[model samples]
Target: MFNESKKAMTAISQYCGNRVDYVQGGGGNTSYKFNDKLMAIKASGYTLADVQPEQGYVTVDYSKISRKYDEISKKMDIDVEAETLLINLDCVELLHGMKDLRPSVEVGFHSYLQKAVIHTHSVYSNLLCCSDEGRDNAKSIFENSKYGYIYIPFISPGYTLSIRVKDEVIAYKAENGKMPDLIFMESHGMIASNDDYETAIEIHETANQMMIDYFNSVEFPKAIIKKTSKGFSSKTEMINKFIVDFSADENYFDTVNIYPDQIVYLQNNLGKTILIDKDNASIEYIMSEKQAQTLEEVLLGVVYIITEIKRNELSLKLLCKEGEDFIRNWESEKYRASLVND
Candidate 1:
């Protein structure tokens, strides 16, 4: 039994890590519940494709997480500001050799899930999640299908999103008599959780293909991921030119952000030579080696996600000013971005 899960973990890591389409940057996470008292989850800032035993995941205390979540979440419901909740989040305990490691912020929902969980930033799945009519379309498609799923509208990642997910799962079970095996997080990606790794991966695959087929039938634009980044163009002139050409709209700030991680990956780091001052409605060209590489790494994702949005011609969902401010200020997110930047 232990060996099966171990092999599953390694396979899961390799499968996800080897594909940027399934997992990008430091986004996406995986977990396995060891028992009622403990669980092993992908540590923050690590990729699923390259995990190495306990080195890749931190085993957390479920009992401690559950207790603190209840406490902090209850206060979050009453408190208007999110600061106190952030401080209280530290209450969730890490076990054994994992104390120094940071757990994925999704631990709340993972703790409430099955023995195995696999979440991905699959681009094909995002074809549906990022669609304008995605929720209604998903309902029409999966409502009576054999696979059970719940459509959650865009929620910023972290305690708040998990709180909603926990409640949604509870309500789904009450209505459908089963844990939602497939959860489509609108404007984000898909999440699959089940008693075993294969079950989880299979569910994601099924839903991902369903989304792919659905979008394909509509004659969706081709997925244009550049498989190799070894020869990516980092010339300041080229980077600035693309920024001006692609992100020149007057409403750029209001509409350009497509994912929270984009902020983590690009917000402060992108366009060292080109800067967007939101309040001033301006773009400036500066210079830096760190900035060039940072922009190169995250620039493609930004361009692609936005390009997909335009291709669909669907009323899009962009990160709001408040949401952007919140995520950019987060020290944890900054740290995660630094891992990639390093």
Candidate 2:
């Protein structure tokens, strides 16, 4: 058990760490089911990189959560959000070494998956996911894979998304006699899961490579930073070019968001902390050093997705207006965004 926990912690950090831009700030989660009932998942407000062998994750009775969803999911009168919050809290195990932390909000879906699961907002996956032609493109791109993939249409996050995913997985399993290794959520991100950690990692990396090779995408560029009186400015050519190309369009920022994490980090900062320095062909953010860096990564990610979509001559499938409004008003996302500075 101890060794499994340590391995899970290490695997979580690898996806969230510097080796790959799989996630930014507190945007993604990883989980490992220790047994039929107990599962370890990243805490709600902590980035995956903060997870360690003894802290930054929580153990939950995943079977209980899964059962509760099955029982209540089909009922029409339940207050899903409130019920889900209560159920999640109740399922948390008061374990010895685990921190007293709230599990990631997407735990509902995690409980339904295999032993090892990684959910990331990868730029490579989003290149196909955030485009209007993404669904068809995904079908064509991954058609020959040994392990088939599942593409989920855009669904609001939280319990609802979990339910949707559960249904899809159930349907897929019925036909294929097993779970899919890769699940792609449109306008969101991807999930790679397997019974073991190493295989799960391989599935994720291979899926990312497939997309990158298909589009011939260059490596995502790093932010070129310079100190400013209030905060920091990005001199990255790609980021600057994006601002220059779309600064005249009033709706560009709102429409350019291809994933939920982008809105979580950038929505509040825009026009306040984040500013366009068109004169210098740079992007500026008025915040502390830590906050500035966090925002820079997210902004760079957004621009990277846009540039890739444009470069491939693909039509962008942006988040709808309603989805943007929901994310802006979501308290859970607001809490996660707040952790960026801490």
Scored by lDDT, the top model is 2
Enumerate residue pairs that collide in model 2: none
- Please give the distance, in angstroms, between residue 222's alpha carbon in candidate 1 and its true position after superposition: 12
Q: Write the residue-wise lDDT of candidate 2 on 225-322 in tens digits.
A: 77988678877777788777767222466556778888888777777778766555666778887777777777778888888898899998889787
What candidate 1 gets wrong by more than 4 Å, as runs, is: 1-3, 76-99, 217-255, 273-298
lDDT per residue (tens digit) for residues 1-342 in model 1: 345555666666666665656676678888877668767777776777657664676666766665666677556345422442353345344554544567776666777777888888777666667667778778867788788888888876776777788899999999988898888887678788888788787887787777667555333222222212322333333234445666543245334776677667655534453455433333442433443444443444445555555566756666667777878787667778677645
Per-candidate TM equals 0.78, 0.94
Off by over 4 Å in 2: 74-78, 248-251
In candidate 2, residue 318 scores what lDDT? 83
Judge candidate 1 against the unseen true structure and give its global Cα lDDT, from 0 to 1.
0.64
> Model 2, poorest ten-residue lDDT window?
246-255
